[model samples]
Target: MNTISSALWPWLALAGLGAFHGLNPAMGWLFVAALGLHRRSRGLVLMALVPIALGHALAVGAVLLAVIVFGTVVDATFLGRGAGIILIVWAMTHLLTGHRTPLRIGMQTGLAGLALWSFMMASAHGAGFMLIPALLSLCVTPGTGVELAASPSVPISFAALAVHTGAMMAVIGGVSLIVYDQGLAFLRRGWINLDILWSLALAGGGIFLLAG
Candidate 1:
């Protein structure tokens, strides 16, 4: 079972990172909670999670698709370093302007609009870019041409995506529910700037990828 355990570790890491993303207030739970309050229905917050999760999935999937399609053509080290640099840049951008950014999702935004907004937010946060190292490990093969074309890692990549998305949904949904029922006043008692923490995490993840 050691072999199986080793293989499953990366997939577990993906899920863990997703959970980490979900815990951040800037991700979606805060918005969902606010939307529920605006709509005067806690159920709306739960419903909002579906589209939010889908949007996040799409943003991450886009990067995964690129890795899968070009893993053979591009060197893994180059791809990993490129993504790492992008992520570090994104993290710095967040640190500098995340709070000052005037972009805000209006309560009037419909489900589809919310989905699109979530996609953009996730992309800007380098959520998918953070997965580059895992993608390289999973999809990049030591073969050329046909051998590389029939990569065994394709299925593993999809499985990792599903696991990550599922974990994110669970965290977002649970947090939204609690925030909705308990009210935001309690959460604001000792306001912590989670954005800075998240930005640092992004930078750290990028560094880890580059180190690997």
Candidate 2:
């Protein structure tokens, strides 16, 4: 039991990180809130969250899957460095083009389009890469790069993904409700462009991975 509990810590941390990501406006909650307000229907916001969460899951799952499969074969240091480079490059591109040449999708865009947008946005932000360290620690032996590829645990991976997705969806739902009912009036007054902050965060995570 103690052993199992210890191993679960990284998954808990992933959920915490998912909650943090959910708090970010760039993560799709703000857009959901806006959609709800525009349509004057809270149902729209509720419906929107499904695709949003799916997109996010896809983004995170891609990186997590890669790390799980390849991190076993490659040296930990090498794998970490490669992920770091990908993240840093992603951040740089986001900073350069995200706001300047933002992708515009109409509010009337269907759920599929919304999902596509969310997927692109989350991928660009390197949201999956942000979870790599935790994933590595959970899926691989610490300091020893020994791969657990032979003993792939479906339950553990499913649990981690489910927890992370649940956390993100919960926050997005809660925040969207508040914003839909109360308005983001306060945010306009103290508006912070969170895109830059998110970019910096991606860069920071990349640096940490590289340093480790």
TM-score of each candidate? Answer: 0.86, 0.84
**lDDT tens digits by residue: candidate 1, 1-212:** 97787567677778888898888777788899989988889889989998898899899888887776766566666667677887788899988877342356799989998888788888777788767666565655423222124366577677778888899889999988888888888587754767877788779868966786
Per-residue lDDT of 1-212 in model 2, one digit per residue for the tens?
A: 97887688788778887897888888888899999998899899999999999988998887777776776577777888888898788889889887331667778998998888888877767788877766666666667755456266344566677888899999989989888888989577664777787788778778977887
Q: Which runs of model 2 end up more than 4 angstroms from their true locations?
A: 1-9, 92-103, 148-150, 153-155, 189-191
Clash counts for all predictions: 0, 0
Question: Which regions of candidate 1 are displaced past 4 Å?
Answer: 1-5, 99-104, 141-151
Alpha carbon deviation, residue 111, candidate 2 (Å): 1.5
- TM match of model 1 to true structure: 0.86
Give the candidate number with the greatest lDDT.
Answer: 2
Candidate 1 clashing pairs, residues 3+ apart or interchain: none
